[model samples]
Target chain A: MNLLFILNKPPYSSDIGKESLDMALAHATFDDTVSLLFTGQGVWQLKTDQFAKLAGLKEFTRLYTGLDLYDIDQLFVSENALDTEQLTRDQLMVEASVLNDEAISRLINQQDRVFCL
Target chain B: MTTRFSILVTGSPFTSQAHHSAQCFVDALYSKGHQVTSVFLYGDGSYVANQLMHPANDESHPHQHWRELAQKHGFKLQACVSAAAKRGILSREDSELSGKSSFNVTSPYEIAGLGAWVEAVANSDKSLHFS
Candidate 1:
């Protein structure tokens, strides 16, 4: 199945971000076709140099670096979200293609399953 | 082709609108003659299956809606076992295995693993999630 996980929450602030990543990883582990689209506050999850340790939280963002090992390389980020957050592609911890609203919609339509968190 | 849907709910019943939205979506699917193959509750969404839930009469009872919908439509209503275990929501079998005298989840809502969710996603024509 073509599964697309749309993450819209900020990392570490709530469990949503971590849970969404876990769900994606779980699907990928089972050899399902899984993709991730980071939008809205979810873009913050990919921010470079996260200091979750200061907040006494484990750095879950580190998992994103290993996603490629699970064959979950179809990562995307919303261009508007990145711009709104004043972040650039260079600031992200992993490489992801930038997608505009139209592209994101197309991606969602193309997926057999969509899980928004 | 008839669209077979698999719905995923990951939000808490009390805190988020996910349960309400999921209920509405299922109702619409039924009205449109679409088949809802499964409804999988993950994360805090397992709370929606709690049989002990007793909301005030005036407020909307989303859990009851889920129960009724499952009964009426014969769709599988499942919750992630691990997630439900952590949240104190257990089926009768789970309660017995854990040596608990009481169970909070009842008919139409079964406890399963993430593998069940994966299967639902793979078998369904489209899967929608509310969180």
Candidate 2:
């Protein structure tokens, strides 16, 4: 089944943001086709130079690099969110397809299950 | 068509509206003669079955409400074991293994693994996430 996870929280501030990714990873490890869509403040989760240790949080952004091993390579980011945050693709740790509002709508429409993490 | 829904809740009881919305949705499904395979709690939602959460006498008790609903509908309420462990929601076995003196998991609420979650989803027609 195709599952889409919509992440909306910034990294480090909320523990759910990390546990939500862990859940997604668990699903992906089960061989399910999973996609991750980062929107709003969630886009910060993909930043390459993240040092969550300073905030007393585990550094997990680099885990995205290993997602492909679990066959979970469908990573997407909201173009509007990135622009709103003045972020560029160069700041991201892993490659992601930047999606517009319409594309995101279509992506969500095609999913069997969509969860807002 | 009787839809079998499997619910995933990721919000806390008192601080978030996710639980309230999920309960009402489950009620609507029950009213329509639909079935629920299971309600799986993850993230902060794992606190739903803390067993130690005793709200004010006049306030609605979320844990009791869910337990009663599960009993009435004959659906299992499962929380991810990993999630529960992270939040200090330990079972009797886990509490003992961890050298803790207290345990919180009660009847009708099972602290299980992701395999249980997958089975719950597989048994259902659709999975709805309330966060």
Candidate 3:
């Protein structure tokens, strides 16, 4: 259905972000032509070296690594969001396609279905 | 072109960039000749429709602005009933029961559930959320 899942929250704080990712993975595994966009606080969910032990939660970053394995590879990150949050590419685990506001506006228009979490 | 789209506002009006982002999204969509099928207010986004919001004269009135623009543009405004009730956004009946002078939720918008949101998704050609 050319679905695009946009995640706007960090992992472990709430189950919404993980549920969104799981939705994308499940849909992609079924060949739904899904894509993922990380915006705002959601960018932090892609950070590397995440250890959830201190937070009393399971490390879910590993789920992101399997995105490619399930063919949901069109991962995008808002350039403005990253810059505003002072995050560099090295701070993230996934290699994402950087997008500015104009780019994000355009990308959103291109999708058939967009689920923002 | 009768293109249909959905907007999900999940953040509070003043606390985050979601307000600006949502305004931009709605403006952009209509400017491009598309129609917003539904403006679904979820989570903190429900505050946007709070009827009691009255800012001072010098400041911009966000809630009023949204209501006017939405009504003028023929956009459907739907807030999650559960969210609104929890936040003290009473319906007409609730307002009467609580003895409020006027109902804040006076526009064409209605209070609905997630199933209604899924309905908007199903009816529209596209869905976009701002938070």
Candidate 4:
């Protein structure tokens, strides 16, 4: 199944985003085709050089670095989200392709299931 | 014709309407002769599984709605064990493992891994998320 996970919350300060990533990994481990879409402030999760330790929390964003290990290779980030944060693709921690609204709609249309977290 | 459904709850039990509203929706589905294969409580939504909740007699809280509905409909009510743990909702095994004095996960509501939700998703005709 083509399962897609849409994460709209930013990293740190909450466990919602972390659970979404873990659930995505679990789906992949079950042999389902899983993908991730980072939208809204969630795009901040892909920014490089996070200092979660400063917030007294573990750097859970590091999990994205190993998403590929679980066969979850498809990752996308919203263009407006990055622009709103004044971030560029080069500033992202991983190699997620920036997606505009039209592209995002297409991506959603192709998925058998899309989970918005 | 849709028959089997898989529900995901992602909102806080008391603070959010996910549980209460979802209970109504589940009943509506059953009224239409549909089957709920499973209801997976996740994120802050796991707070509903904390059966230790005690509301005053004059009012009702969101706990046990799923437990009762699942019993009537013969469906499974499960929660992500890790998420439930983070919110202080523990299963018997977890309570024992962590040496906690008590466990609050109510009967008919099981704490499970996310793989169980995945299985529900794969087996159901459709999946719905309440937040």
Candidate 5:
């Protein structure tokens, strides 16, 4: 099944963000088509040069590098959210397709299953 | 084909309306002859499984409602064990293992691993999350 995971939380601040990543990886491991969309504060999860280790938190953003190995390459980030946070593509750790509101809506509508976390 | 659903709750019971929203969604699904295969509670959402919860007579008890639903519909209601443990919501076995005097969770609301949540997602036709 095609699964779209919409993440809306910042990394390290809460376990939900990491758990959502785990969920996506698990689905992809089983050969399911998995996509991840970062919106709202979730855009912070992909920030470049994170030092969560200094804060005594698990560095889950490092796992994004391995997402491609798990066949979870459909990464998307909301353009509006990035703009709201004054972030740009160069600041992100991984390559993600920047999506506008309309594109995001279409992508969500095309999904067989959508999970917002 | 029967529309099989897997509900995921990631919000705390008292702090957020996610549990109530999940309950209403499940009720709607049942009324429409749909099946809810499982309800996976993660993060603070594990608090919903606390058997010690006792709300006032005027307030709606989401945990009690979930317990009743699990009993009536025979759907699996599981909370993430690690999350629950971190938040002090323990099952009988977990409580004993952790050397605790009492447990705050009971039957029909099992404390499980993330594998169980993944299994619920895999087995269902659709997965819905509330937070």
Candidate 6:
């Protein structure tokens, strides 16, 4: 299935986003195609310097690098959302392409199934 | 067309992408001729149906937008009753019977269970989760 996941929460503060990311990883590991779109506070999860002990949450930032191992490489962040949050790609731990709201909207409309976390 | 849905709105009216996304989905669904049968407002998303909300001069309240949309389009706005009651939002009768101070939920919207959300998924052609 062509699955799309829109993550809204920061990686460090909430278990929901983490669980959903784990689910995405699991699905991709099982040979499913998964695309990830980060918007709002969710863009914060991809930032650099995110360690488990400092954030007091399980560290999954490393998974961003390992996603290629599972073939779930379509990672994108909304440019407007990133700018609104004052985040830059240089601050992200993983390589992510920036998307405008129009692109994000189109992606959402095209997905076979979308899971937002 | 087939109805596709299952939504999650965690942000409150003050700061959240949930309301915007939900509205966009509604417009998109309608334009595409799909249907939205049930919307699940969990965590802070439950505030969409709060009847007592009156925004002051400062905030661009998303609650008002949701309220207007729900009223205008006949969308089913559901707040998790457990969360609603815990947060001191209930129907008038619920407030009187339970002895609560605030009544947060009323008509146009209803308090429901997670099973209802599951039922929506099962019955729909597809499920779209809005986080």
Q: For model 3, how does the per-residue alpha-carbon lDDT over A1-117 read when each residue is reduced to its tens digit?
A: 688888888887876675466546656766678788889989989888888888898787788877878888899999988998899988888889999999999988887777776
* Candidate 1 stretches greater than 4 Å from native: A100-106, B92-103
Provide the lowest-lDDT 10-residue window in model 5 chain A.
A22-31
What is the per-candidate TM-score for chain B? 0.96, 0.95, 0.86, 0.94, 0.97, 0.81
Cα RMSDs of all predictions? 2.7, 1.4, 7.7, 1.1, 2.3, 8.3
Candidate 2: count the clashes: 0
What tens digits encode model 1's per-residue C-alpha lDDT throughout A30-72? 8899999999989999999999999999899999999889999
- Residue A84, candidate 2: C-alpha displacement in angstroms: 0.7
Q: What fraction of the native interface does candidate 1 get right in terms of contacts?
A: 0.42
Interface RMSD for candidate number 6? 6.2
Better of 2 and 6 by lDDT: 2
By TM-score, rank the candidates, best first: 4, 2, 5, 1, 3, 6
Number of the candidate with higher DockQ, 2 or 6: 2
Candidate 6: the clashing residue pairs are B90-B104
Write down the worst ten-residue block by lDDT for model 1 chain A: A14-23
Indicate whether candidate 1 or candidate 3 has the larger lDDT: 1
> Which segments of candidate 4 are over 4 A away from where they belong?
none
Error of 5 at A98 (Å): 2.4
DockQ agreement of candidate 5 with the native complex: 0.55
User: Chain A of candidate 4 scores what in TM-score?
Assistant: 0.96
Misplaced by over 4 Å in model 3 are: A1-112, B94-103
Which candidate wins on DockQ? 4
**DockQ, every prediction:** 0.47, 0.60, 0.13, 0.82, 0.55, 0.14
Best by TM-score: 4
Clash-forming residue pairs, model 1: none
TM-score of each: 0.84, 0.95, 0.56, 0.97, 0.87, 0.52
Clashes of 3: 0
Give the lowest summed-lDDT range of ten residues in model 5 chain B.
Answer: B113-122
